[model samples]
Target: MEGGKRGDEAGPSSEKLGELSEKLNEVCHVGEDEEDEDEDHRSNGVAAGFVPGPLVSLKEQIEKDKDDDSLRRWKQKLLGCLESDSDGQMEPEVKFHSISIVSDDFGEINTPLPVDENQIGRVLFTLKEGSEYRLKLTFSVLHNIVSGLTYSNTVWKGGLQVDQSKGMLGTFAPNREPYEHTLEEETTPSGVLARGLYSARLKFEDDDKRCYMELKYSFEIKRQS
Candidate 1:
């Protein structure tokens, strides 16, 4: 009976050892599975602290699309300014009358337009004495990077001169119906005016019942011939 009881206790110890070995095998297999998964991710260029290559390409494409849209908008604005008129139609014909120069003693002179700044001359203009065009003239002096609005009138016949040295900045007059007038210089000196490319800007506007037509002309200053 003593030998049999010892054998039975030994049998329980052996069974317990077999169960522990099975549990250890299961733990090792689970750890191996996790390691394999980590290796697969690294091989595909994706890691815990990395960005994917495809995501960078998508960002560049989005920036390119934004630039293309901005360029299209700028083109549309420029076309509107050039092609569109008051009634959203193309502009029509514009005709401007000729302007000349004259002096009191010499009458109508043949001098070139835009005489020298200090040349002491006059500009003669002739228009329909009483017309319904409501034509108006404006004289502008541009010199030394400055532009000054000198005179404005609607006379039928007149002359004009702009001189900064003699204090005769700019003046106009009505001499005769389709005649000449002299633009005199001032004896007193006001101040020194800058000298450079100067111009006379003329603007004309005529309105019909539907839409209006506006025209602009610029005459530059030139040396005496």
Candidate 2:
């Protein structure tokens, strides 16, 4: 009788263990699904045909065709007021000042760069659902020319990537004044299902695939109150 009782007790314990194992498997599958989604997103980006070129200094380029007056004049026009002697610096450097969201209803909301660590994961701003908006980035370039400066943004909701976008901001030469580039307009997703907090990563890179800055932040989409 004691042996039978022990077996009965073991039965409940075995059932409990089975339940726990199933729960663990579900959690692991969820994690794997998220990883697969991220991998697919990366694959799509790689297929976009962005190939980084070899890095060459502006001074070396200018010296290559010293005898070609027409080429020299064209280079001068392309580089603006940049003096040829100013190529003393080695690699290009970019410092972001601020990012602003412009909208017809909300006007403009600006956020200064180098966000505090404490605020990194916090919601920086809220947007009205279905509202059209544009992002304006203000930054300064120093040292050498930044070739093929590009901006990319990826957004996620509930551990699932919802959107991704990339655009070229063009090459820039060192300048005393900051340059402002406004992105193409975008409309926020509408409806009750779209109203929620979303996380996003913004990245800035050059032709050499050198990342200048990366920022992770959150925002909320709400119905206009």
- Could you say which candidate leads in lDDT? 2
Error of 1 at 81 (Å): 42
lDDT of 2 at 27: 17
lDDT of 1 at 100: 36
lDDT score for residue 150 of model 2: 74
| lDDT tens digits, residue span 162-219, model 1 | 4211111121111112212233321211222221222232222211111111222222
Residue 171, candidate 2: Cα error in Å is: 2.1
What lDDT would each prediction earn against the true structure?
Answer: 0.24, 0.69
Q: Which runs of model 1 end up more than 4 angstroms from their true locations?
A: 1-97, 104-190, 194-196, 207-225
lDDT of 1: 0.24
Give one digit per residue, the lDDT tens place, for model 2 in 1-225. Answer: 122223322332343324221211111111112223342354424424666444456565545444445444545555554664566566678999998989887799899998889888778778999888898999998766776777777899999889887777877767778999999898899999799999998887665556788889998899977
